[model samples]
Structure formats: C-alpha cells, structure tokens
Target: MKVKCPTCQNEVEWKPENKYKPFCSERCRLIDLGEWASESHVIKGESFNQQLTPQIDEFSEDLPPADEDFFKH
Candidate 1:
C-alpha cells in the first residue's frame, strides 16, 4: 500500500524495507523531528510536566546507595 508523507505530503510506499515509512525521505523525517524539537507540535490537553518533575527527584533521592553487591545480583 502507499500513503502520503506526514511532513511533505509526498507519496510513500508502506513496506518493511522503507526505514522512513510514512515519510518520503530522510529529509522529511528530520523536518518532522525539527518541528517536534521546536515545540511546534503539541498535544492539546492537561499537562503533567510541572507536577511530575519534583516527584521524580524525590523518588531518586530515596533510593538506597549502590554497593558491590548491587552488581553481583
């Protein structure tokens, strides 16, 4: 089957051999990545980013120190 590239609307073949499936070329894939990196693409809804960061830091601090036995397991 064939599908249009999400970035450039070029036709692309849907196949296992096509590494950049859904994109016509590497250029189109990278362009999509750039859009994501620049925050040009965002999901609409509630954001948990602000709430989870401090919880992660707190959890990491609570972890026990690693010793030689840690690797043996």
Candidate 2:
C-alpha cells in the first residue's frame, strides 16, 4: 500500500519489511516522536474544573461566634 509520511508529507511505499510502517524512515519517525515529547503536538481536551466542580466549605463556618460580648461600653 502507498502511504504518506506523517512528518514530511512525502509519499512512501508501505511494506511489511518496513518497521516504521506509517513513517518513511526511522529519522522521520523519531522526529515525530520528538515533537510530541517537546509539547509541539498538543492534544486538545476539556479542563478538569469544567468536568467536575470543586467542593468548598461555607464562609460562615470559618468565622468566630458573633454572640461574644467583647465590646462592653
């Protein structure tokens, strides 16, 4: 089968003997891997916060008691 190398976009003949089936050669395959490792190729996905809202404690729960008679005028 005929396939284009994902890195160079060059047409290459695919054969069972070629270890890098989709890629034209080892160089191109390694280049593609390097790009991914360096974050050049990023996978787009939703954020974790958007998927799950965080649980927060109520603000009133953190305050001292209002009934304390500290101000005696």
Candidate 3:
C-alpha cells in the first residue's frame, strides 16, 4: 500500500523493504526529527518537566511528616 509522508506529504510505499518507512527518504525523516529536536513540534500546554513535580498546598497543615523509618538502619 502507498501512504503520504507526514513531513512532506509525498507519497511513499508502506513496505518493510523501505528503510525510511512512512517517509519518502532519509531527508524527510531527518526533517521531522529536526522539528521535534528544535521544539517546533510541541504537544500543547503543560510540558513534561512541569508535570514531574507535584503541586504543594502551602498552607495545608493536614499533611503527615516525613517517614522516620526510611532513614533507620
């Protein structure tokens, strides 16, 4: 079957024999990679780095203290 390249919209064969499957050539594949690497292909708001840390309620006194058993030998 034939499909269009996501980067250049060029028609390409959807076969295992093509090293750069889904892309017309290595250049098109590399072009897509470059866009991702340069942050041109972002996935909307709230980045991955920001999601890693959970938000803390500053005035919430209902939280428990750190686990004391964790540091015990």
Pairs in clash, predicted candidate 3: none
Error of 3 at 71 (Å): 38
Q: Give the range of the ten consecutive residues with the poorest summed lDDT in model 3.
A: 55-64
Q: What is the C-alpha lDDT of each candidate?
A: 0.54, 0.52, 0.54
Number of clashes recorded per candidate: 0, 0, 0
List TM-score per model, in order: 0.52, 0.52, 0.52
Per-residue lDDT of candidate 2, residues 2-60 (tens digit): 99999889898998998886999775765565354434532122332233223211211
Clashing pairs in 2: none
Q: Lowest summed lDDT over 10 consecutive residues: which window, candidate 1?
A: 42-51
